[model samples]
Target: MEPIKILVVDNEEDQRRLIGIILTKFGYSVKTVSSAEAALKDMDSTNYQLIITDLIMPEMDGTELCERIKRKRPEAKVYALTGRVELYDDHKLEKFGFDGIIQKPISMNSLKETIESAVENIRRL
Candidate 1:
């Protein structure tokens, strides 16, 4: 079986590395990038099964990034990893092309479940 490939995009180096480490420990193939621009460039060459991006970032925000990604890869599973979940409702998130939102201050257990569920859904497709 192939490992799930994930791309995590965050301006904060600590946040990026933390997610990468956690996903790696979860037995996922993870890649981390510092900026949305960098993430877009990386996507040009690679297709990740899952993309977790910070809502707030320099230059391009997660919503915009997800929108652009979806335009390119409509099947891409792009999600928001933000703390301010209250600011954006499901309608807004969906309109921006995000498949779902993952709240920040992440819980390892939930993260694992989320990823597993997503992978399962992908497999079904």
Candidate 2:
């Protein structure tokens, strides 16, 4: 069976690398992009099962990215990652169309559980 693929989008190079490394260690095929625009471009060729994007980005935020992705591929599972966790309320996140939210300074256990849940949900459908 093929390993589940994931895309990590973050403006910070360190953050992207860290996420990629962590997910890869967890037996996932991971790709990292510096911006939402680049991620959209990458999506053109890659069929990523999950996307985890930083909530605050310069040109295009994670919310916008999630919107665009959902428009193009409604089945796509996208998660929001934010350092300022309190800034995004549940309503806002639901309106933004995120499958889940990850607070920065990420908890590996939570990340794994969220991804597993998303994958399992997809499998069920």
The models' CA-based lDDT, in order, is: 0.89, 0.90
Question: Residue by residue across 1-125, what tens digits does model 2's lDDT show?
Answer: 68888999999998899889989998989999999999999999998889999999999999999999999888888999998888997678989899888888978898888888988887676
How would you encode candidate 1's per-residue C-alpha lDDT over 42-68 as one tens digit per residue?
Answer: 999987989999999988999899988
Off by over 4 Å in 1: none
**Clashes (N, CA, C under 3 Å) per candidate:** 0, 0
Flag clash pairs in model 2. none
Task: Please list the residue runs of candidate 2 whose C-alpha ends up more than 4 Å from where it truly belongs after superposition.
Answer: none
lDDT of model 1, residue 103: 81
Pick the lDDT winner: 2
